[model samples]
Each structure stands twice: as C-alpha cells, then as structure tokens.
Target: GTYPLYDITASPLTSGTHKFDGPEKNNPYRVLGIDEKQNYARFRFSGERNKRKLNVEFLGIKGEKLGEWSISENDLKTPKQ
Candidate 1:
C-alpha cells in the first residue's frame, strides 16, 4: 500500500484533494501454485499466502491451464486475469 508498488499519484492536502485517487495497479507477491504436485489443487488459485515474487497459472473448470502470471510488488499493471 505504498509507492513503487502502487502506481498512483498521492494527493496532498491541496487543491481540495484529500486522498490518493486512481485504480490500484500492482500485483501483490503471490503464493500458491508454487511448486509441483501443487499439493493444494494444481493450477488453481488456492490462495495468495506467501509474500514474495512468484509465478502463477490459472486453470479452467476442467482443470486445464489457461494462462500464466508473475505476481510482484512494483509500479506495474496488476494483470487482471
């Protein structure tokens, strides 16, 4: 919830603006689907537990890989998959 991770402009207590305005565009270091066996539902977004840069992959209803993504904290688009 800080800069570098959230690419948004901070609004100072001037110009009548009182808070930061803009959509949050940063992916939080994800956790899950991390290692093989998945052990907790392969390809499924079991959960975002760990706080570290890690890779993730989405799955379809039938358990098919849909796409891949890398979750990290930086001034980047939080890929809305």
Candidate 2:
C-alpha cells in the first residue's frame, strides 16, 4: 500500500496545540500538534485498506531521534464494546 509522505518538520513547532495542512489536498486528517510540556502529541490517520503497520519516530528540538515504535494494525483497531 502507498501512504502519503508528510514533511512534518518543514517549520519549527512550538510547545502547544497547532493545526496544519497535510500532504494531500483537502485532507481531513491534518492535525499533527505536539505539546512538549505535556509530553504528548495528537494526529489522525486515514485508514488504508492494505496497511498492516505504521512506524512512528520521535525527535527532539535539535532533530535528534528520541525514540521509535511501530503500531500493528491489530493495535489500531477499535475494541469491541
């Protein structure tokens, strides 16, 4: 499956909420806000039928990699109520 590549670090991100445009035009999943003080970030994913896993990387202020992880499709699925 082909996934759209996003250049998230095109501009310096501050320590607060933010909203930006995605790689695809008119994309709804466009929020990629990261709050350093709160140690959390928010982003939405557009479901891909053939995607089995997603890889995420965390970077510091100086562009150093803090950590990395992979999310399996199973873990991304909503649990049954």
- Candidate that would win on TM-score: 2
Cα lDDT of model 2 overall?
A: 0.48
For candidate 1, lDDT tens digit of each residue in 1-81?
Answer: 223352222222222422222432222532222222111122223334443454555444455664565545432444554
TM-score of 2: 0.35
lDDT of 2 at 70: 53
| Candidate 1, poorest ten consecutive residues by summed lDDT | 32-41
TM-score per model over all chains: 0.27, 0.35
User: Candidate 1 at residue 31, lDDT?
Assistant: 28
C-alpha RMSD of candidate 1: 16.9
Clashing pairs in 1: none
Candidate 1 residue 46 C-alpha distance from true site, Å = 14
